[model samples]
Target: MQPASIDKQINNYLPQVTVNQKKAVLTVVKTFAEQDENEYSEEFKKELDSRYDEYINGGKLVSEQQAKKRIKKIINGKSK
Candidate 1:
């Protein structure tokens, strides 16, 4: 098998719990570290950066009205 597939299998086999019911946070960290980093495309990166910038700089939250409007647009098939 390929290295990535092998590593994923190994990661999946790791123990998920310990003695005191503490969550396996290290497993999440390790999985993130071992993840295929290049799966994100340039466009996806640009969109992620834009959303992160908006959240950090504008501190914007999605309003119910905006969500309703988006839903309406989606239901009408008007959103591309």
Candidate 2:
């Protein structure tokens, strides 16, 4: 199908929703509160540890509340 035609059909299914409902839905969609311990491979763990070190040293670590606000801003199509 043509891109424009597909976009039009998708838009039909997604009517403009209220900001509150949109925020709630986006929160549920993006938030994964649990992790599977066995799913992490050694290489993935190494990469994650490296990035964690950089984030800590760069002073870019955020609290849970700050992280939520940043995520909400992203989902709402707004800048952080």
Candidate 3:
């Protein structure tokens, strides 16, 4: 009845399933997940659109090297 038990049961039967059966199961899971009723607010959508437009219109963007350096600093717990 628990999630872990269900996961273990599914894992046990996975090896016996064909590739097509696995694909079918994945499709069904995706369909079920896509049925979520959550909706973003209009203000949030507008903020996203504004940010996207700014990025498209040559807004200041970090270079790949800078991004990697920032990520490494965060991972190493070093403050700027």
Off by over 4 Å in 3: 37-80
lDDT agreement of model 2 with the native:
0.76
Error of 2 at 13 (Å): 48
lDDT score of residue 63 within candidate 1: 97
The weakest ten consecutive residues by lDDT in model 1 span 15-24
Residue-by-residue lDDT tens digits, candidate 3, 1-80: 99999999999999999999999999998887776546677898999999999999999989999999999989889653
- Sum up the clashes in candidate 2: 0
Across 19-78, the per-residue lDDT of candidate 2 in tens digits comes to 787778667645643344337878999999999899878856779999999889888895
lDDT for predicted candidate 3 compared with the true structure: 0.91
Clashes of 3: 0
**What lDDT score goes with residue 37 in model 2?**
38
Give candidate 3's root-mean-square deviation (CA, Å). Answer: 8.1
- What TM-score does candidate 2 reach? 0.34
> What TM-score, to 2 decimals, does candidate 1 have?
0.37
Which residue pairs clash within candidate 3? none
Question: Local error of candidate 2 at 77, Å?
Answer: 2.6
- Scored by CA lDDT, what does every candidate get? 0.76, 0.76, 0.91
- Stretches off by above 4 angstroms in model 2 are 1-37, 55-58, 78-80
